[model samples]
Target: MRPLPPEALPVIVAARRTAIGTAGHAFKEVTADRLAAPVIQVVARDVACLGVPIDDVVLGNCMGPGGNLARVSALGAGLGEAVPGATVDRQCGSGLAAILMAGQAVASEEMELVIAGGAESASTAPLRAHRESPDTPYERAPFTPAGHPDPDMGAAAEALAAARGVERERQDDYAGASNAKAVAAREAGRFAAEIVEVGGRTEDQRPRLMRPASLSRLPAAFVPGGSVTAGNSSPVSDGAAVVALTSERLRAGAGLPGLRLRGGAVVGCDPALPGWGPVPAVRRLLGRTGVSMEQIAAVEIVEAFAAQTLAVTDALGLDPLGADRERVCADGGALALGHPWGATGAVVVTRLFTRLVRSGAPPGTLGLATAAVGGGLGVAALFEVV
Candidate 1:
């Protein structure tokens, strides 16, 4: 592939996210649009000095109310009636998918600036039901049609663990380490700069110390006698993340440090083993970009389930226990911070922005953000500090 022109490149100039709140907790009364609007406002403000009108707002959502949430959130943020919005849905990968779409639009040179991210309020998600059975409620919409094997996310994780020989002990250990890292980062105020306060909440609701003993005692949450458990999986949560993306010309003219969008890939796999999606997705992205794992200074993968995370890392030849682990999720992940479905993908990107851009990594430092979707799909994007 030929290199893109400088003016056609997409660069992320600013990113912001609300403090994550566990479902039915601090943000229960807040709708998805409300959760998203504040973050959008803050990100827009962060880049206001550029003096460019936002051409559009794109957001990814899974279980929010049926309307175009991106437009609703943009209006709620007071971006004015001229700024249009579009919503994307790719289940768990919605957030990252939205960012990729925005990058594409910027690369095409049709827009000068755009606000893109994802938001999810699991606490306020409506009860869903099929039209044929309106009297009964379903937990979620099916990922695949009747002919394909589509297991619940938890069940799929369990199956993946069993198939890949991931043990309960390993999962618990990984979860404990992730929690500990998050707690330490929080105490160190590493997350303070990127977090936007909403409803007076300035901290994440789920990170805490996880002792091995307590994690060992928790019973299986999905399949009977299964290794997958709530202690090792992401909690339901509410949160929103948004980033300001602009063409390279704008970023250079403004003299702002940013992350240049390098490459992105989305791939599918067997619906029965959705957690394995990230492996192929990352491989595809790395291959396309010609960037090796050794070149990436930071990596953030959505830790939806400890077993699933371990499986992906193991397949990718990453060390989850060694010093190399620090390069991956240096602060923490969804396993410790709670997963807000659509928002989690954007959360990882925000984390990358913090670690690579905000922390002063040199220009050209590489970072990757990826997620495993619920229906056997994966999304991965590579970014370089600019």
Candidate 2:
């Protein structure tokens, strides 16, 4: 892992995402390809000032049709056939993985400008069946090897909470706070710059004006007597997000010197406690970048569940339910915005972009975006406002 030349490091110039739609509602009729196409187009148009041809379009997908979906998305976005595409699938980490790969390409000078992101349309996810019995539907493939402990995500979150001593009341309170922040951000038009309309929908479909009493009343979802509840977990979602990455010269040409890719790490954790994924990933990222948590001005860790969110913060030695909690997702997170599986990793990064770039954070400020994935994986990235 040799460091890339400073001049060749990837710098994001523009980024955008479609307002997240609930799985069975706003975007039910859309496919992953369709949801992603327009966002890529918007980034391309937005970054045209760079005057550099897009060398590739890399996208992450989870349950879309089995084909070169990045190619389909590139074509659909009108990037033309000449701009080849690649797709990556690390389940929930797919989107960030794609962006990581593209950023490395730019850092290595293999490309000048690249479009990278991810999309997911759970509503349009094809019904999967085992090959042994083609007609019998299955929910998903095994995330771990046979006979190894594998728990449903909700169950894992519950176990993590129990292990970490995070109580049900705390989880419910966190969920309520997340929703309130999201509602406030929406009302203040904080997301106006990064959200693009799709299918005539202009706003995210997941943010809720939840009352604490209401959140406390929601039933547990994973296990009997468990703290993990419907109110604290991410819902089925559909959305797409993208960012334009280029070298320093190209970013300067675009006149929008977006966040610079400082360092990134993808790490594996225990399959049984998959929610702990971000712990190792973020640690590795900090180690690589030589940046301390104290210097990170903003952070967004995907909140698939409040329990996992708490566990991650505690593992990072931050106050899971205190000031650090506010620093983690000041404008809300997946708990409030909805986690569109494959697209969530990119969504967090897009959130970081808005915070550092659109919100006028000063140069040298540090931002981090991270996500825990299905199958015991985590992805984390460090960005510097440059």
Candidate 3:
């Protein structure tokens, strides 16, 4: 694919997300469509404020009903039957991939305006039963094919930690800091700009006050002698996020803050080391855009596990420890927010949208949103505050 000039890329006009709910708890009764509908409505309402017609709605999903979730969410959100929608499933990378697809469509002039994001409701996801074994039930299907290693997500994190030499103390410290940052952000009302109310809850449900000393005492969750722990890993969650994409001309006409989609990339790696998936994806994105890490002001890398988060940051030459890690999630990440599968990727972009546009950052500041998928895939996108 030919690289388009930065000016030719799509611009984000609006971004919003529902407050993430704790799986099987705060959102136990909420379906995926129910969780996503309100955010889509708000995002569409924001686009209507700009007087631009929505051309499409693309959403990402994992464990939700198998049909077109985008269509269900759109109709539920009152987008009207005239609007068509589609859903993408790339595991956890689904949300970022959907946004990237929308950007490409707009940049190619195939679409004038698009709404792209991801949604999930772990609390309400139905049990699965394969047709071959109708009476038997399963939690999740295999991500890799036969003959390939397909470790559970938790097991992969533990293996990555052991392979990378990430210490348990380091993982605990990261988790504790994540909670602190998220708590601080919530207390400061920093999340208000992007988070919309859902189920009468306006704040993420996972983040809590956790001391490092106590976090260190938690037992390992994956392997008996391993470092990955439930406390240091992202909890199952429920939520949705949506962002409006439009051409540069429409953005100027709307007179709204714009964030340009400079570049994006998706790549596949070994299924055994899925956590490192983001490394190649980000590298490809930076290579295509000619944007270096120093040029990027903020980053939102999904915190599926402290071990994997540390490994990715170390691989990318970013600070993965102490206060410096704030540059990555600034407000917080999945570790503190909650991981609603597909929605986490879109939530990360919403975080960047808040940081670069709503927060009054200087013009031309760069931000990154990236995620590693369950099936050995990594997706990444680069944006600039306009």
Candidate 4:
């Protein structure tokens, strides 16, 4: 890839995330803003040496109180009344989408510095009811119109598994490996640097040693007599993650080591098969950026469901069970780390920052972060260590 002008280049200087907590468990009492404030504060403090004022705070949120979550979080972090905030909602892809928006602002020379990421508190998301039927509550809003098929995420994952010929054994094995990897990484303190302690919890709430044998014994969770199971799916969780992005000029002045935002793409697909979104999104991103999958030193794809994850890897010609798997989710994924919806996208990017930048990888080492959205959308971003 060719070099971009310093003023128009966007680089991520710092990233931080609160420890993930299982919904209805560790973070049941916390609100979304509270979950995100500490992370934003830490990320902002980390980049204070750059001597650039944060122009805006952009956050992604799927479910929460109706007002602007980004503003609420920014204020909660004590950023004062001067800095402004915006929110993005793309279902599961919200976090990455917000980051892409921030990068665009910097790349377009519209802003010099921005705080961008996502936060979610499934435990405290507000209930909903249409105005016409005030007494009746709905679990979620429609992803498509009346004529289009809009399946629940779990059902869609099950259908995807059946259509893609992903076997139950493979899903269970993949999930088991993810858990094992996460446990090992935690024991080795691989996640210590990226995680910010929250609410007296110093470690992620999920991730256990789940062997394939034990996983195989679990029954189907979505469809009767089907392969998808709770054991192989990401749990609804609460957490927040944020990254500080600034122009390359500012980064150079500060002598900071960071990840340069190369390019990104967002694409839509059939609502019924939302999990397949990552395939085309990634393809378009690589084609647009003139980068190939072989060049990416690390890849992070949100693991919403084992079946969905397998389908995506298979379609992309990635070997989830082979040596290539090491380049993907090296420390495990949402299956082991827990999926905090809007926050998972930023979480993946944070993982990439840790893998490529914090680990002292060579400059220009490329990495990719992609996620399948809940409402027929996919988001992908490419980065290079600088």
Candidate 5:
């Protein structure tokens, strides 16, 4: 119930974002772990942890070639094997899941210091082996598809849009907002401090990491049925983010990058109608913090689907067209840059921390991240920058 400190606000000492190139392009040759190593190092390089114990490294990843990617990426980051790790699969929710876990370890006083973040290289990320039989659980269950990811994220969005009564015009409008917001942020250089340079396979036979000129002008890949399009939906991209958290007493006694963990939680909905997942998650966070929506100035919820975002807004009685949600994701969001599955949560949190750190920033700024997975699985996290 207590407030987190500025340093205790899970001080995001440093942050980085990769340019979200189109699927299978610049980052196509890179693996997820390789893509994430730089982000982890940048955040950890400046911290002094000689005697301070690192509780663990918690990571997020939605797609991988095999198993235990969190651990793989952690050790590969050169953080060492002495530190334990966890790889969470919450579909699009993985990144936020990692941040929530890191916050929990510190808030519960379970450990004083921790490394938490998420990453995803959806572009090069490989697909999983499909179920061989109708009896297979992965095939039979629904994902709000009840359990099957038959149509993938875009298809799911289309289905959700129809189910939630979201009009095509509204979906188009939402996508447009995402584009404009991101353009504003980019022009303002808001993400200058957070987006890190992510190098990947070069195009045109150049031996360098040049920002793709068409990164923003790329066309849509999912609009056949209606408003959902590649431009509006997140692209298959590569990126990562990490945070260093410590306890109140320990931080006070030392000069390390200090960040106190606030409260965090997750919830689920019927996988078939995941458009409604954020309701309980938001309610739980607000209820736990006792902070009313009116007191919160901004939000950074992951827009997995236009329907999901609209549903959460409707449930909260938030008018997307109004000023209250205006401060949300100021720089842009998944719909614009891209969604690197496991990396989105950390990316949003990293940006949220930046927003809180700047002077004259809004007060009682509440940071919340949510994601929908196959079969009604949704995860959410609420943060307060004190």
Candidate 6:
């Protein structure tokens, strides 16, 4: 469903994202709850720079110990107590969900400077369940059967790849490209602007006495046969992203250069073909705004897997190889950095924001943000600087 009252000036004026810490290693000591505040506060604390009051904080998390995490994190983020906060969960799309909500609220003229973002310290992220009472639907009620449940994104990715006839090796190649580009971007300091340094040990933690390891030695998570190994897949990560949005009134009234959110979109595909959704969402956003794919200077498709990205790129009619690919994902991707589920979406949006700001292109450079959710779901949000 579309967000209400679809059209005013809820533009994302400023956005910032934290470095994608290697889960368990860099962020091993951080709790999911504790991670949110610092990552988001790194930027939201600068509300003064944006010149607007923070209307709300919408946060996302794939998993957390308790309810009210959004509110708790917001409080920790240094809000003035009066600023209300809420949490959202859309699995891998959770971060995007937060960003969209903020934009919707602002566009509806109900708010200004809505700070939306998400975080996850998958290293410290605990699954919700009582080990003593594993079968109880009672405890799982909030996050599972009711509020934020969906098919796992991995299973969906595998299914989508099969249904779409995506080859495993081809997917591996895509993963390789993601890593190569990401490494290059890091080398060039392309991501230096977005990834904030956290004073910590490694991003994830290794047991104290279990010191050094061989270069080729690393534990693997998930399946062993497939190309989606720990190296190829997104890293278990810890990070957050926040986009401080301001309305046109707030921008004009407060004398700020608030970038408009324009209209963002989400599209759905059959669960078995979930990877196909972005094609439609991208088309719709372009159709609605009278823009074309070629016009887009940068596009950020969540690298749920190399295959998912390759599939989406092919479906969008962009050359999966050659020059067109270069225009997309210029800042690297999840495969290279890390993917912290809920944080992944906002991470993409935050990166896109930086791309636009740094791009040599004029205002109105179209940017696309996309991700796949569980249960045959996908979302694509488009933005063009103005």
- Highest lDDT: give the candidate number: 1
Evaluated at residue 276, the lDDT of candidate 1 is 96
What TM-score fits each model? Answer: 0.98, 0.97, 0.98, 0.97, 0.81, 0.84
Once fitted onto the true fold, the runs of candidate 4 whose alpha carbons sit more than 4 angstroms away are 1-7
Worst 10-residue lDDT window for candidate 5 reads: 201-210
- In the range 1-386, model 2's lDDT, one tens digit per residue, is 24565566798878899999889999999999999999999999998888878999999998898898899999999998899999999988888888899999998889999999999999999998888999999977778989887788889898889888989988888888888899999999999889988999889988988888888887889898788999999898999999999999877765786899988899999898888999999999898777899999899988999999988888898774687766788899889999998889999999999988988889888899988987799999988887
Q: Hey, what RMSD does candidate 2 come out at?
A: 1.2
Candidate 5: residue 350 Cα off by (Å): 1.2
Off by over 4 Å in 3: none
Give the worst 10-residue stretch by lDDT in candidate 4: 1-10
Q: Residues 110-129, candidate 4, lDDT per residue (tens digit)? A: 89999999999999998888
- Tell me how far the alpha carbon of residue 33 in candidate 3 is from the true structure, in angstroms, after superposition: 0.8
Error of 4 at 316 (Å): 1.7
Comparing 5 with 6 on TM-score, the higher-scoring candidate is: 6
- lDDT score of model 6? 0.68
Question: What lDDT score belongs to each candidate, Candidate 1 first?
Answer: 0.93, 0.89, 0.89, 0.92, 0.63, 0.68
Q: Give the local distance difference test score of model 3.
A: 0.89
Deviation from native of the Cα of residue 168 in model 1, angstroms: 0.9
Which candidate do you rate higher for TM-score, 2 or 5?
2
RMSD to true structure for each model, in Å: 1.2, 1.2, 1.2, 1.6, 5.6, 5.2
Runs of candidate 2 exceeding 4 Å displacement:
none
Model 6: per-residue Cα lDDT over 15-129, one tens digit each: 7776677776666777765666765676675557656667788988876665767778878878778888888887778898888888888776788678888887777755554
Q: How far is candidate 6 from the true structure (C-alpha RMSD, Å)?
A: 5.2
Model 1: residues with Cα > 4 Å off, grouped in runs: 1-7
